[model samples]
Target: MEVVSSVRTPLITGGKTVGDVTQDICVRVEAKPPKSWFLAMAISLTFLFVGLYAVFTTAWEGIGVWGLNKTVGWAWDITNFVWWVGIGHAGTLISAILLLFRQKWRMSINRAAEAMTIFAVICALFFPFIHMGRLWLGFYWVMPLPNTFGSLWVNFNSPLLWDVFAISTYFTVSLVFWYIGLIPDFATIRDRAKNKVSAVIYGALSFGWVGSAKDWSRYESVSLILAGLATPLVLSVHTIVSFDFATSIIPGWHTTIFPPYFVSGAVFSGFAMVLTLLLITRKVYKLEDYISVQHIEFMNIIIIVTGSIVGIAYLTELFIAWYSGVPAEQYAFLNRATGPYWWAYATMMTCNVVTPQLFWFKKIRTSLWATFFLSIIVNIGMWFERFVIIVTSLHRDFLPSSWAMFYPTFYDVGDYLFTFGIFFTFFFLFAKFFPVINMAEVKSIIKSTSTSDKALK
Candidate 1:
């Protein structure tokens, strides 16, 4: 009996050989980054600088530079923070949660998603740091040291402190998780590298991986443990983010439904961002053979399911607000639908609630252009969701006297633009430097395809 090597391509597939698929995927890395890449990089960098300038000018001036006032203390800055954090959640969900379920389709797109998570978290971190008004002493919030002159202690009970802890932990864990997965793939690149500079950099990052049996064994074990640890942390981080609102005494913010609602919304929005990136990347890298229509369809199912859950949460909040007869909560919900920001609220409902329902159609879900446009719509809706939640809830609190409308000033808009600038800048850089797809995981999938073919024969 001859033992089949899993690493080899199959002899036949629909009368076409497996070599064709491998050639389609592996050949593109040989080509230089297109002129379009430089164009995108230049554009993203310019936006990034403008964003930075906005942040710096605002920090030097004060929160007064923005449209935020006493009633709506947290406006665009907090909305942008929560939105970016929610966007970060999908990467860990794909890399860690799906891995535990043994979803092999994730292999092709997880790398890019994980990179997106890291960049999104970086964008999220910016708002909180600068929103402090006094950036130099912002570390005082979490330094864990007793204040000598002011007798101030970091409020352990405060949800804001909890957010600090939660966001930092999430960022660190995501970075580690992403880098560990990259090591072996980096080693593969190092082996294939022709230039001394490329070889040295990739070789250093690979941590001298030789692909020994023992090394693979340990690597697999560590990956499993990390995935297990990260799954709960991913769920918890967003829950805690919701707590930043729920734990507040504000009527709209103080709800028990927030944790699950936020998690679902996070996953929904995160998947949208993932779909947006993967759609472009698969085409740019000519990786459709690996990141197939099946993968896109599976992700669409997740988007629909999560989107429906989020829509239900929205309705449930309205029902609870009315049924409870809590005047403040009722007012909050009413104001969202019929208040100064009503247009934003309706936009949220239309984009997040109505648009994603179209994915129930197989034709819509599988069509790349349809999915791409829907992904953009989902992101827009998600942003509006955060805005509605933050602004609507806080803008008009219990006392009618304190009620006021909030709009983003130039500084506030700057904060948002910079956040996008940073996110796209990191993403563009990732595209140029790294293996946007995990070569090892893709190789394994290719090997599995070969085995499935042989078994069929």
Candidate 2:
């Protein structure tokens, strides 16, 4: 009888056993932070400080501290918000969608991906609060609670309100899903803890998780239900985000294709971010056995497919603009390509549309250095994609008299850097203190050897 394995190759390479998995993950957490970790943290701290300074200046002075005028109100901040939000989708996609499909390969990488999603959402949430200028009032006012200011309710008709609900829901579900998955791994760490302090910390985190048949049965059922719940968020969150633009009457912002286009672009950028982090993480933590080249190649293929879809969306936007014969819509696309911000549009095209095509070649997709470089490049393109959609559309409006160009102040650039600081700071800490790879799930697949592979034997 021929036995079939779901994955083409064994995910946990280097002949690792369950004990080996525990030791490998636990030691990293228990050990002191490495020099590389310190160096990365130092860089993140520097950026974080710069961002903090910018935020202080902005709050002190007002939104006027950055670049905002009548013509371009939603420039860098909203662009960064949407960009970060989109990059977050890959995490939920990997954990929820892949789980529902029973893709065994995801077991090795889902933990880190889900963590990334949570952090990315945290970063994304920062914008709406900060962009409100009056952070104190804006944050609270967005919530639909009865207040001293009677009848001052949130506009339910607004897509911005939709964004508020959608993002909060996405963040909550992703956090719950992530924490639930971490329980078993926390238990593993708890059992392996050598010190009293470490043991207590892990015990608290594990929530009394025991390696029992009953516990395992309950765990699996809850995970499935959560995955079922989170799967729609993988689509709905970005779709609502797209609604922020699609519902608007602004020529470039309003479009039927916005939902699917935004969704594809979100997933594309998200996979790139996952690749970016995993490649570095696998190397830094010596996790090559768990996060393999095959995994990298698989994600790169996703980038290729989604990048192509985004490229098509770009062309479709242009074609639709022309076909509609609406002067405002047509001018928006033409201006985006040929306007003063043409550099941005060109950069978006080259990075998002043209760059990922390289992955089509087997050599490039499999090459670690190439994949890492392209992943960063893909994110850069995706960021500029948002910038083009926001800044370019707003800079040149229907009225020539109101036309203006957006130039980012140091504060604008600094605010953007702040999100990076927060993202990496949280991620690096997660890597150092937790099992970056999912130990419980990977253990189950360690022996599901491919028919021709001798690694298991």
Candidate 3:
């Protein structure tokens, strides 16, 4: 079927055995934290504290501190919220969808990808909460709770309410799926723990996974069941997120193509994020054998597919608007390409549309440096995609008096940095404690991920 590639490549390069896989992955847990890791942690913490100050400033004053005016009410924060949610899509796709298809290459990458899903969702959740401005006081107002103050029962049809449902459900399922995958690897760490403190911690996390035939049977059953449950979520959660705009009366956002378009773009950005993280991790941990060049190439190919889909969606939106003879819709897209924010639109097109096409040549896709750079570019473009849809649509209206250009304050920039801080800090912590690669899964596929041609045949 040529699932990933027609010309086969080794999934794992080193002639590693079962024990080698365990040792390679578990050592990251048991060993002393590297100086480089600590240095990286310090930098992330610096960003965290700066972002904390920004949060305090916002809470102390109000969302008024942001550059949000009447016209461009939903600017950077909403853009960031949607961006992070989309960034999270690849993890579940890799962990669930690929697993369902029984793809062999997903084993090494799925564990880290799943963790990325959980963390990215947490980051996404922050925007709406903080954007509420008094969430700490009346966040419960979002729920279906009975109120003593008035007859209000929360708008059942509000798009934000759909966001509440979507983010919560998506977060829960992805967390469970991630933790479930970690159990077997956690058990492996427990068995190897020389220190009592470490052993106890890993033991509790393992949930008494004994790796027996019965245990394996049950494990397989539960994993498959979870995968089945999660597969629909990978589609539904993002569709609901797209509903936040698709349901809107705004010119740029009012379109039928949002659901599928959003899903593909989510996968696109998610895979790019996974590659960005994985490439750095591979270099730092000397894990080139497991997360091989072939792995990078496979992912780059997916970037190509999804990136192409996004480009087509861009054109489709323009065509639909023009063909429908809707002046507002037509201007919305035209203003995007040739208006005050034309640079943003150009950047989106270049990064999301043109950049990924370079991967049609195998060399660019296979090159580690090239993959890392393009992955980052794709994410930037996707962020701008959301920004364009939100800000450009709202910045100028049918009423010229309502027209205003949105400029982000330090609060907006800082809040975005805050998510980055939280994401990397947690990721480094996760890398230190958890097996970034699924040792048990990789061991099960040891014979399959071989480097030698003889093994392939």
Candidate 4:
């Protein structure tokens, strides 16, 4: 017989019952959205329009319109690409890995986190296409197609080519996994939906879920299968992304530690992004009972672990540069800390390294305001970390005569703002339509007497 301890705090607070969980989550879906949602949508649309104009300018006049010197061919584009990709990492980790571990706390946040992974990956994909100058003409070049198709073959040796394969596969798997988890919840909404149109739409999305024993058995099996498939991707996707730099011969780019290092940094930033969005969402949607302080603390603990790993990785990079006794490598890192872009490096260390350490104090980690503020600070630091890694390393060349600093044009900021517009806009819409909390899973947790009995005893 298995024994369970009741010593731990409740994962779902407020003494919520199965019925309470369903009603609370389903009401958000059934009711008309509040005025605040409309106001928020209006602001996001404003940013979206600005971003669209910037993308249009880049596509029309070419990437040459932005500042790119001979020495620094990559600037904000790759930096933001890596940053957004990193932001997407936490969702799969939270959804797949935690699910595999049989962690019950994930029930509340997995829906939004999985949705975040989808949207963030979409935003990350924009850079490489835009970087090609004429995305419409060159976009197909990256497709993992047969050379025999005779549209010609992609350069198999290119790191960009590998990124095309890895990120796309990651996106496809995440989308399916997210949608799969939503089916039963969709069915719930379908049953509760009063309008004919609402019933029809949700019924279709649910794919005829009937809550039968056989249907549930199949659902559990499929979720496990998909979770197993996604678990490796959490580690592999970021590892492959790290290869984009690690496989290079550049002084700062070549490193063996980058795979694990990148993975940890990705989780660090990803969790911060999740917290940033979730904190506001719970308050706005009045989901405090489902997403409680305990949940926030649990997430904060993970942030601490990942943040420390990232901090160690940062120090490891510095140590390797010193211990390797390679002048170019030494100068490369030294330039990052003391060169023209030293401020960026400083910001990265302070935000990613220093701010997260504050979570060591329970008072701060559990405080909603502190968690939200630091989460934003962590993401800002991560963006600067990418910028410092990309621009600082490239700005100083072998010869001082060839060295040049990269400067962003209007498009750089605008393209980034474009992604912000896309992410928040889609997120708000998702919150408005779908059950933000996983209604099916939350009900199961409360309804499962077998699990609750063990804890009760």
Candidate 5:
């Protein structure tokens, strides 16, 4: 009699064994950080310092340092916060929601996406905190503790408070999800440890796991439970972020359609971001076999579908504004199309509405360079989408006397640069230190699909 283990075989192509898969991931994960890592770190650190300097200068001088005026109160800081938060959504959606849906393809890229989510949320946090000139008292906005200065309670009805709750919850949950998934891989690294320092560090992180059957069982169960917890959380985070605008009395922000609209846009941009990162990681790490053309094509389809939903939302907003017959609403819609910020509006339409249509072709979707370019376009469009929504609509309120144009000051621009630095800086570090691909998930996928490999081949 012979004993067979499913874990030993290749699940997809049958061209490689499970050992091959593990070896491939180990090689990449254990490799020394490249020269590019140092270069990127130096540049990002420089920019981060510049960003901090600008923030402190603004804080010391007052909010007057920013281009934001009484008429246009929320400027680049708030816009960047919303944009980065939306970008962070794609990570949890891919890891949690798609995992629950049993999408095997997500296994190849979920690790990097989850890392991106955590980092993007970190970047998002800077805006709300620093945007308040008196950063020391920033906690007053959310703290339920009694304040003697004014004896005023924090506004429970305010969407800003909701943002504080929603973003904090989203960030904490994402961090836990990411760290949990890394435990097994960290143990794998621990066992393969070649030095005392590496052994102790990895051992401590792995939590004394010996990968027993019982441990694997509990691990799998915990992952599923966490995924279940994260699914609604991913949706709720963006929906609440939308309420920050939708609950407002401003014309464009007052629409009932904002929650779904923002969620779809968040997913669309999030997928775009995931695509951008995975494309590079697969190439850099030589995991083309794990992150295959098929995976890229599947995600492209998602990008197209969600992109179309966002495109429809754009048109529908216009239709509803007209049909509502509210003068303020109609004017806001008209302003988006033909107002002072029409250039920004046109840029959004081009990037969000038109550029993504190229993915309808399989050639474009699978072409790494093409997808990369489109991803940047999608990001640019998404940023402009927020800009157009926040700035253009507020530039001219209900009254002509209140109308004003908004432009970003140097501090405003520095804040945006800082956000980019934060996102890329964390990503660069992630690529260096961790297995950007989730080895455990990929191994499981390989194990489960081994039988299908024979038939396909």
Candidate 6:
């Protein structure tokens, strides 16, 4: 038995061979889902139908059905948009950023993460479209198309328009990158397909992948190129989203730190989401050996660092508000921490900042149960972080006379649930119908796991 050395520790465990990797991942797609999967699907579909009903009612009755008023026009719609967009970032980072850094740990997690990224962006896109009262016209109107009305075009200066381009580009790139990575795995599934339907679908998706040395050579080259393209692209997506607020003259929204702060928060929430989804996924699918404790520990470390950065950003906002001596900014910060919605502020502080700090302990970071709960807490804190930024800023501006409180209606809650439905529906389908793990990439690392085991011996 020849021993192979690796740069870092092994990613796979259980002494899996290449054949074992293919059989393990492919059988997941070929078999019927467990009873738990159906229960989850039923729950997801209930939310989905509820969301659809809300969307239909909103369309029939108009945007007035929800909680939008003159002062707090954005409310939950934009907050959910930013939150979903932030959640999408971790997927791209897991796939592209880690790939660029040549981190083998990413190989175990990136496929599912990339799928999560695509689904999350899909959820984020719903708000802007649904926010338009006349969604029919608003859809094409937002695009920079040559129209019969001469020289009429979208505002190039608007960050909202920039978001349109940024998100669309990010989605396109992520989709292509994810699909490209899936080709080899898809081919693996195609080869092992027992039925004609599975064979044809997987064959078409694989694009005639033959597993030649030349084919693999090109595959690696393409993956590397795409990773380079996606690295800055993911960062830019969230940064542009932050610009939607930072470019505003609103007292709390106008901050120079918005870009990096938003990016860190996005990555932080994204990792929390990945942890939440993957923890359940690995256990449900019996993939603990592939996704292992070491991988969880490393992701926990990222959450700790990014969570700390977010906490610092919170304090920095307070310091800058007071240091500037701008009365409106000062009052905005004060209102956030002590206003009618102070509970939201407190929740954000506790969840986003304080909770993730537990990862600093080895015991907490490595514990699957602990990581699962903290991941959910981090997302909740992140949601509040967005809510605090959007609603708190808009509800009270420079004018004392224009001040008002924001509240979400049943429809608002429904649309938020809709995103969850969209996310989980797509995720469960992907898990069952496709290779959740990247078989080819994991195969390359099988020997690395063996080498590490030998070293321990």
lDDT of each: 0.85, 0.90, 0.90, 0.89, 0.84, 0.91
When summed lDDT is taken over every stretch of 10 residues in candidate 4, the lowest stretch is 447-456
Residue pairs clashing, model 2: none
Candidates sorted by lDDT, best first: 6, 2, 3, 4, 1, 5
lDDT for each residue of candidate 4 in 1-457, tens digit (9 for 90 to 100): 4434457666766667777888998998888899999999999988988998999999899998778879999989898899999999999998899999999889899999999999999999998889899899665677756877556678789777888888999999999999989999999999998999999999999999878999889989999999999989878888988899899888888989989989999999999999999998899889887788988998999999999999999999999999999999999999999988989999999999998999999999999999999999999999998898888888998899999989899998888888888988998889999889888888877634223434454
| Structural similarity to truth (TM-score) of each candidate | 0.93, 0.97, 0.96, 0.96, 0.93, 0.97
Which digits, one per residue and each the tens of the lDDT, describe model 5 over residues 346-415? 9999999999999999999988889889998999999999999899878887668988888788888877
Better of 5 and 6 by lDDT: 6
* Candidate 6: C-alpha lDDT: 0.91
Worst 10 residues of 5 by lDDT: 1-10
lDDT of 3 by residue, 275-306 (tens): 99999889889998899887888888889999
Off by over 4 Å in 1: 1-31, 148-151, 450-457
lDDT tens digits by residue: candidate 1, 284-399: 77665667787899999999999999999999999999999888889889999999999999999999999999999999999999999999999999999999999998888767
Query: For candidate 2, what is the TM-score?
Result: 0.97
- Candidate 1 lDDT at 449 equals 53
What RMSD does model 1 have? 3.5
Residue 224 in model 4: shift from native, Å?
1.0
